[model samples]
Target: MKKKRIYISEAHKGGRELFYIQEVFKDNWIATEGPNIVGFESDLENYLQEEVHVGALNSGTAALHLGLILLGVKSGDEVICQTMTFSASANPIVYLGATPIFIDSEVETLNMCPVALEKAIVHRILLGKKPKAIIAVHLYGMPFRVDEIRAISCKYEIPILEDSAEALGSSYKGKKCGTLGEIGILSFNGNKIITTSGGGVIVTKTLEQKSKAIFLATQARDEAPHYQHSQIGYNYRMSNICAGIGRGQMEVLDNHVILRREMHDFYVNLFENIDGVLVFNEPSADFFSNFWLTAILVDETKNGGITREILRAALEAENIESRPLWKPMHLQPVFEGYPYYGAKVAETLFENGLCLPSGSNLSDEDRERISKTIQVVFKKEIKNS
Candidate 1:
């Protein structure tokens, strides 16, 4: 008999999702504005606990676009972004007709390298286009080098657009990831720690910025009985129904984080004796990751020619799902020809990294299957030796 397929990351619904969703139906508050939306935002604010205001949007990409606007990234401007992130991190720069200068990742955090970032800022300044903002991401729930990156941001006087889309539960040095930057964003997409179905939020330092983001997100309507517009806008507000799901998910967010971290531990223990496989982990005591997805780097030389792809195939044969790490934006065809700083660090990570199954709802049977599949692959290496 064929085994069930295991996904890399999947949404796990808590018991209360239906309760909040039903409240929306009962009240006929089916539109974008409703009690659930307000309650959901409040829950996030309290959980984040930094006095930051949040404006819910249709997607994390929308949040990024609004974040750039709030940071004053206008046409013909230049913005610096981490290359080792999802395209959403860079797409907003293009949305505003600004250019993105890609920076490479460091080996330690697999995030923006401060050295490369400083170099990019200086070089861009020399070219007569000072960057308006910096986009730094907490990749796969691992907080970036927050102190180093923030210092660079201060020295260059460029505000950071923190992409905490994958880091809702991650923290650095006692502060939440989203609260570290001048402006931040969180994703509640279906695959994230908490799902708003398909929603995100832009975290601002003040209520005024949050109000402005909501105004822009809701088509920038002027205050009048008749429809009037002072500037351009977008239809980006999250629906009340989706926020209902978020409200329920928020009820169990911490538990989900715990489960995901336990999965990371599972992989760490699984690979402890397996040669050539290094699980991606927090570098030091200062960082706390959600372990949204547990990833590993495969060293083919030490594994007797077993590469990431080969191991991925081994899992696939057993009806499991796995994926490669993000190919750095600098290497993507659409993003090629853009100004890129730093060396082949991002490239090397892309070549060797693989994301494993890390859903919070995985059962003991599922883990046994995954463990058995991986063990079979390494056992071959031992036999070859």
Candidate 2:
């Protein structure tokens, strides 16, 4: 019999998840408003230290769009975003008809480069248009250089939109990732640490921001009994059913973080002795990564010219799923015309990086099979060299 295929990430839903969903159905509260939605938001607020108000939304993209709206980003304004992140980080910029100025990543954290960001800010200022906000992401659950990024934002007097979509359980200096910026976004997509099936939240520091986000997300309904509208709005509220899933998922969130860290350790141990393999890890003690998806960089110079693609193909032959790191946004055709700043760090990372199988529920058999395939590829490459 053929072995089971191991994927890079997968949602782990149990009876508890289903039980919550059933409760929502039994109560006939399947729409966007319900006790589950309130409970989930409260749970997140407490878990994240209550420093920020949380607004449940349909997806992380919705959270980002609302965050930009809160930041006063509008048509013709420019927003500085980390180029090495998922496109969602930049797509919201275009959603508001604002341009995104892509900043490259640093090699250590594979996140926004502080120096490049400052350079971009100054360059934009000289062009007579100061960027309205900065969108820095915690890529792959690894926190960016929070201190440095915050300092730069403060110096420039620019607000930050922290995209913690893949970093809900991650932290920097003991503070949660999603609470670091003026406004933060989280994703509960099936692939994230805690799956709401599909949902997200926008986090902010004040009631006004929270209320405004809620208003804007719910079609900007004015205070009236009948249908009313005073401004533009969106249909981005999370369904109560989905919020129930989120509530249940929150119950096991800490456990999920622990399992993800264990997976990271496993990859670290497996690749420690491999000459050309470099596991992507927390840059320092200050950064606590959730290790959402364990990734590695294969240095061809040290690996006798063997490339990441070669190993990716070998793993594919064994029915193991992996993926190349996100290509820098500046390289994407849709974002090509935008301005970009920094050296080739992000470009190099894209050239050699690959995500490994890192599902929190992966079995020992899955690990052994994956490890064996990788070992075989490296062994053959060494032999050929």
Candidate 3:
């Protein structure tokens, strides 16, 4: 019999999730507006602890789109984005007819490079089009250099849209990731720390911003008894059923973070002495990563020329799933024409990085199987050498 496949990430569902979903169905409030939706938004707002208001949206992408709208981004404007992130982070820029200027990642956090960001801002200003906003991401649950990036954003007077989709439980110097930016986005997709099944939320500092987001998300209806029309809007509100799942997920979020961090430690111990394999970790004390997905960089020069692809293939042969890091947006055919600034760090990471199985539900037996498979690969390399 073939071994079970070990996925890089998986959602953990429990009784609470099922109970909430059943309650939503029992209440006959499966659509956008319902008690669970309102309650979940309140829970998130309180968790963030910055007097921020939240608008539950249909997806992280929708939240990004609305965030752009809230920031007054318009056609022909330019928005700077981190190159090494999921496309959703940059796609919203295009949704507003604005161009995205890609900034490469720094090695420490594998996130936006502050120096590159400043350079991009200056270059854009020289071209007679200052960027309308900056979208900085906390990749793989690791907080970016928040202080440095905030300084740069402040220096240039550009608003920041924090892409904390992969970093809900992450913190920097005790401050939550999503609360630091002018506007922030969170994802509750199935593979994230918390699963809403499929949902997102927008976090903003003011009630006015939250109200505007809620109005726009609900199709921008004008005030009147009958059907009315006004500004363009989107049907991006989260369903009541999904919000129930989010509420349940929130109950166990801290446990999820602990499990993820444990998984990271396991990988670290597994590969620490391996000469060419370096696990990506928190760069310093200030960074408190949730370690969403344990990733590693394979330096072929020190590993007898064994590449990331070779290791990935080995894992695949054993029915285990692994994946390469996100390809920098600047290299994507759709984004090839956009302006990019920074060194080749992001490109290098794309070529050599790999995400290992890090599911919170992984069992001891599963870990043993994964460890043995990895050991076999290294042994084969050593024998071949």
| Candidate 3 backbone collisions, by pair | none
Tens digits of lDDT, candidate 3, 193-276: 898989899999899999999999999999999878778988999999999999888899989989999989998888866779
Worst 10 residues of 2 by lDDT: 376-385
lDDT of 2: 0.92
Candidate 1 residue pairs that clash: none
Q: Candidate 2, which segments miss by more than 4 Å at Cα?
A: 380-385
Clashes of 2: 0
Model 2: how far residue 251 lies from native, Å: 0.9
Better of 1 and 3 by lDDT: 1
Supply candidate 2's per-residue lDDT for 258. Answer: 93
Candidate number that wins on lDDT, 2 or 3: 2
Clash number by candidate, in order: 0, 0, 0
